[model samples]
Target: MNQESQKSVEYSQYYNLECRVADQVKAKQYNGALESLLNFITLVMHRQYPPGELIGSAKLDRLCEKIGLSFYHEFYGNIVHRDEFCSNDDVSVIICTGLFKSGGTSPLIGDIVRAQGRRKSTILATNSLGSMSGDDLAMSRLGEVNANIIICDKGNLVDRLHWLVQQITRLEPSRIILLNHHQDSVIIAAARPFTEKTKVLFYHHADHNLCLGVHLTGAIHVDIHNVGFCNCRDREQVADNFYVPMTINDLGSDFVRRVFLDKRRLTTCSSANPHKFSNFYFYPYHELIIDRLEARNGFHIHIGVMPESALQHMHHKMLERSIDPSRLVYIPWTPSLWKALIDNSVDLFIGSFPIGGARTAIEVMGAGVPMLMHENYLTRFHSSRDIAYPDHFLWQYPHEFTEVISNITFDDLQAHGMRSRDYYLKYHCTEKIGLEDELNRICDGTSTTRPAPLYPHHPDMLDRSLHFSYLEDMAIGHSIQHDRATHVAPVAAPLTPHQSVSLSLTQKTSKVIGLLTARTYRNALSLIPWLTKR
Candidate 1:
C-alpha cells in the first residue's frame, strides 16, 4: 500500500482502539484503562500518532478523574489554588522527576539540584529505572547539598500518586520543581493542589516531543535552552516562561583540555544509552563504525551499559559489512565519563544518534574531544553552538557523517575541541556560580514576562518532526506494543455469562449500526463483555 493509505489504516485502527479505551475509562477500569490512556499519549509523544490530534492536558486531566484516579480525585475535590507563596515551610523546595526514560548515567537532574538547591530540600524520584542501585549520581549529589531522597517507583499509578500527594502535603514545601517525563503526569497531578502556595516550576529537559504539564496554570515554565523557551511561549504552554541556562557539575579545576596532534589514526568513543542506537534508519551507523575501524589504527570505546540484544545486533550489522567487530570495545559503566575519555586518550566523541545526549556532549567538549551527532531533531532550543546542541557537530545522513569524520584534520580537532571547552565555560560554567542566586530570584517571582519575538531556532520544525513521522506507522507502533506489556498484561475481564452480551450468528452488526467500516466494526467489539480482554 502507498504510505499515506497505510498511515490512514493505522490511524483508523488506533482510533477504534481508543474508543474501546474510552469505554474502559467510563467503566472505571483503572488498571488497564489508565495504562491504555498513557500508552496513547506515549504513542502521540513518540510521533506514532497524528500531531494535530495531540491530546491536551485538560482532556487527560478529565480522563484521570473519569478513570477514578485517587490522586486526581483529591486534586480536584480537596485542593484549592492559593495565590500566596509560602516561604516558611518545612522543606524549602521539593523536586520531583522521572529517571526512567533517558537511559543514560549522565547526572542531568542531580547537576541542576546540586547547582541551585541550597536551602532545605528534598529530591523525589518517581518511576525510577529498574530498582536503581546506590550508584545513582543524582542521589549522591543530594548528599553533597545535604538534601533528602525519596524513591517512589512502586505500585499502580493510583496508589503511587495518592502516596505522593500525602507526602507533598506533609512536607509543606515552599516551592516545587517538576522534571517529569512526557508521559508521567503523577508529579504534576500531585503538585497541583499546592500550585498557588508552593509555586511549581517545570524544568523542560525533554522538549522535542509532546509532554504533560505544559497546560499547567500558575506554574513557571523554565527552559534550559532557548529552543524550549520559544516553543513553550509561542505555543502558550504556560502563563510564565522563564529562561534558565543549564548547568553541569564541576569535577574540580585540575582537569584541563589537552591538545591532540595525531592525524593518521583515530580513536572514537560514545556513551549514549541503548535507546538512541535502536532502529536508527536515518543513517547507517554500523557501516560507518566498521569502515572507520577498518581504515584506522585505534579501537572505539563503547562506554556505559548496553543491552545484550543491542550488542548482538551490532555484531550482526558488522558481519553484514564484511568486517570483524574486534575494535569496538564495550565498557559497561565508569565512575566518571570524563575520566574514562581522558583515560582512553580519545580522539573523537560520537554523540547519541536518533536522540542527542546534551550532557554527554558537554562532557566530551570539556575533555577536549570534538563531537559528531545525528541530527534527528534539535531537542533543545538555542541559537548558539556552545551549549553543545548545535549544527557545528551535527550530521544528518550516513555519507555526510562519514565525510565529516574523513575531512577532520588534527588542526581542526585541536582548534574545535578547545573552542568547545571555552564555550562550555562561557555559557554553562560561569552560570553555575550564580545558579543558586538565580534560582532564588525565580523563587521570588522575578521572571514573569514573554521577552522575545516568536521565531523557532530551526528553519522548519519539519527537521525534527519528520523523524517521528517516519517511524509513526511501523517502528513506534511496535514500540507502543512493548509499552503496553510494561504497564500490565491484557487478561480476560471477570464478567460472567450472565453479564455477557453476545450477538446472534445471523444478526448483522452492520444492520444495527449502519455504514460501519472494518475499523468501526472493531470499535463495536468493545461493548461485548464476552469478547472483552483487558
Candidate 2:
C-alpha cells in the first residue's frame, strides 16, 4: 500500500473511511450504521464469561492476559492504562472504578443491552460493586428499550436524581423508579416530576422502629417494602422471594464443571461498618460468634473489608480479637476473588446482619462454601423481615454454630462445600435468572414488575405509636420505682395523723428558713455601707 492509503487506514479511528465504498453503493450514512454495527460486533468479540468458572481455561487465561496487559503495558509511552481493556463511554465510564464488578465476569448493563436488549426484573444493589453492577445491568437493559428506571442509595444521599432525570429524558424511557434508605421523609419532601409516569420503591436497610416516621408520613405515595427485624416473635419474618439465590449456568463446557469438584474457602467480603451502624451494634450476633471462635485454636478467621479506611477499621478489632492481619483480605477482585475462593480450602463462611444480602454471599456459595449468617426479625426501614430475606444456604442467626462446627468434620466441610456450590449454580447464576426472558418481557411490556405495597393513613397508626410510647413509659417508670425501692431507706416509723401533719408543717418551715437565710445574707451585705457611715 502507498503512504497515503496507510495513513488513511489509521485515520479510520476518527473519520469514517468506508464513505467511498458507501458512495459507490449509493447508500447514505451506511458508514455510520456500519460503525455502530462494528461496535456491536466488537462488544461481542471481546466478551468472555466474567472471570469465574463460567469461562473455560482458555478464555479465562485470555481475559486475565488482556486485563494484565492493560495494567502492565505502557500508554502515552509511560503511563500504564489498565482501562483500555474495552471501549468506554464517559457516562458509563464508572464501570471501571472502585470495588465494582472488576474481579469476575459479571456483565455490565451496557453489555446486556448489546447482548440481549431489554429485561423486566427488579434490579437491587447495595453501594458495592456486585450490587452496583446489578443496578447498572438493570439500567443498561432498561436504557436499551427506553424503559423507566429508579434508583435508591440507602444511606448516602448522593443527589443524582437531576442527572438521572436528564438521562431518562435523553433515553425517552416509559417511566422511572426510585427508592431511599433512611431519608425517605427527605426524599418524599424533595420529590419532583421528571416524567409523567414515575414510581418509587421506599425501603429501609436497618432498625424498623424508626419506620414509625415512615409509616406516619402520608407522603409515602409510592410503594414501601421493608426488610429486616421488627419484633422478636415474628416466625414469618423473612420473605420467600428474598432468600432465593440467583442461579447461574456454566457458560463453559460441561467437562470443566465435571472436573472441578473440590471444596473451597470462599469468604463473603464486605465493609465491616455495616452501613452507618457500627459492627458492634449492627452485627451483635456476629460479634457473639467471633467471641466463641476466639476461644478455639484450630479455627482460623478471615474478615473481608475494602477501601484502606475500611481495612484499617477492620484491622484493629480483628487484631484485638487475635485474628491475624494477613487473613484480613481486602475486597474481592471478581474473577480473581472467585478463583481464590475455588482454589482455597475454605470450610464455612460467616456473615454479618448489618449488611444486605451481599453479592459476596452469592459468589462464595457459588464457589461451594457453606455460609453462616444472622437473620433478624425486622429492619428499622422496611415493615417486614420478609422483604429482606437473605439468600438460602445460610444457617440463620441464633444458630447452633459452635455445635455445627464441632459436629462437622473436614469431610463434612467438603460435602457442604459441594452442596453450597451446587446451590449457587442452581439459583444465583445470571444465566439461570432467565435474564433474556425477563428483558424481553420488560421490553415488550408483557410483565408488570410488582410495585411495593402502598400504605394508607389509618387511626390505628396513632394508636399503635401511643401504645408503643405507653409501653416505653411504663417500663421506665417501673425501673425507676424498683431502683428507689431497692436502694432508698423506708420511713423509720409509721406516722399518726397528727405526726404526718407536723411533718408537712416542718417541711414548709424548712423551705421558709432557707428563703429567710438567703434574704438575711442579702440584707447583711447591703448594711455594710450603712454601718461604715455610722
Candidate 3:
C-alpha cells in the first residue's frame, strides 16, 4: 500500500480498536476488550521483521534476548534467579510512552497493561510519564503484577533505541506495542533515513491536543480505541475517540516461566546529585530503609556510585540512619576502581538515578547481584531499566522499600546470585539489541513522547537548565581570566622549585612545623611584596 492509504487503513484499524475499548470501558467489559486488543496487536501490526541482511541471524538472536529481558525486567519485577526466565511463551509488548526525555506517564501505564501476558508481559520505553512524574503510578501498577516487564529505554540516544530495534528485527517475537503521537513523530524522523517498509505500530497516548496534529498530518493512529492521551487539555472530543487499556488479572503459565526464572539479589542503585529532587539528594526513603534495616540488625546494603570522591559528600545523617559505615559499602567505581569494588563481594546493588545507575547496575547484575530500584519511570526509560535482567528486575517505591527488603531471605539472596549470572547470559552480555531497539524507537518517533515547551520555562521548572547556563557563563569568564593569567604566570609562581621543595622538606621534617617552616607563613610573607597587585 502507498504511504497515505496505508496510514489511513492503519488509522481506521486503530480507531476500531479504540471504539471497542471505549465500549468495553463504558459497558464495564474492560478485561475482555483489553485482551482482544493485545491479541490483535500481536497478530497484526507486530509481526513484520526486517530482512536478514538488515539484521543478521546472530544479530537477531541477540536482539530477541535483548527484548526478552528488556521488556520483562521493566514490568515483571526483576527476579533474582536465572531460572526465572526459563520459558519464553509469553508475548512481550513495549509501550511508546511519549517524545520528551522526561515525563513518560504512558510508559508508566504500560505496567498495568503488561499484567495480561500469559507468559511474560512488558511495557517498553514510554518515558513521558503523564503530566507530573507519576512514578508512583507506574510502581503501583508494577506492584500489582508478577508476569509483565517494563522495558524502559533510558540511556545514550544511539545505544538505547539500537538495542530495541535490533531485537525487533532479530527475534520477530510477538510484540504488542503502542507509540504516542509526539514520540512517534520523533521516531519517524529518525526512521525516515532507514527503509519506509518497516512496520511500526503507533498509538497516541495523548489524543486531545494531538488530535489536530494527527488530523493535520494525516497520520495513521493505532490504539485509538483503547489508549488515552495524557497532558492534552480542553479536547475531550479527541479523548472520547478512545479508551485506556483496562487492567488484566489472569496472566498465563508462560508469564510464570518467563519472569520467575532464577532469583536475583535485592538492591537499588543511584548516584548523588546536588539537586534536592535527584535520587542522590538523600531523601527520607533512603534513611527509612537504613533505619528499618538497622533496627532489625545485620543489614548489608551496597550503594554504588560513579566517582568515589562523591562519597565524601554523602549525607552523614542519611548514613547514620541506615546502618554503621561498615554495613553500607559506598562504591565509587571509575574504570580504575571497578575491579577493586567488585572484589569486595557486593550481594545486592541499589541505585536511584538511571544515568549513573545503568552501568553500575549492569555490572552488578552481571556479577549475579540483583538490583532494587525505587522505580522512577523517567530514568527507567531514558537510562537504566532496559539493561537489567528480566527476573532480576525489582520495582520498588521509596516508602515501601524497607518492607520489600525485609522479605528477602538469606537463601533468596544466594539464589539470586546464581540467577544473576543467568541474567547476564540473557540480557546485559551484549550491547547490540539494546542499541537497535532504542534506535528503532527514535526512528519510529515512539521515543519522542512530549511536545516541546511553548516558551522559556519558569526558572524553578528549569533548575538543571538554569544551573548549566550559569555554569557555562562562569566557564567562559574563567577561560578569559585563565588566558590573561598565562601572560603573568612567571610573576604568580615566583618561588623556585628548589626553594619550595626545600621548604616542603623542612616542614615535613619538623613535627610542630613552626611558622618559619610553614608554607602558609611563607606565602603570607611573600604576599607582602605583591600587596599592590593582590
Cα RMSD of all models vs. native, in order, equals 12.2, 27.6, 23.2
TM-score for each predicted model, relative to the true structure = 0.71, 0.41, 0.30
What TM-score would candidate 2 get against the native?
0.41
Best candidate per TM-score, number? Answer: 1
Compared with the true structure, what per-residue lDDT tens digits does model 3 show for residues 428-478? Answer: 343322423432454354543322122111212232343234334444554
Compared with the true structure, what per-residue lDDT tens digits does model 1 show for residues 126-175?
65112344455443323245567777756766566667766666666766
**Steric clash pairs (candidate 1):** 226-381, 227-381, 227-382
Which parts of model 1 have CA positions greater than 4 angstroms off?
Answer: 1-36, 46-58, 61-90, 95-106, 116-118, 128-143, 236-239, 261-264, 313-324, 377-386, 389-391, 430-433, 448-534
Clashes of each: 3, 37, 108
Candidate rank order under lDDT: 1, 3, 2
Q: What TM-score does candidate 3 get on C-alpha atoms?
A: 0.30
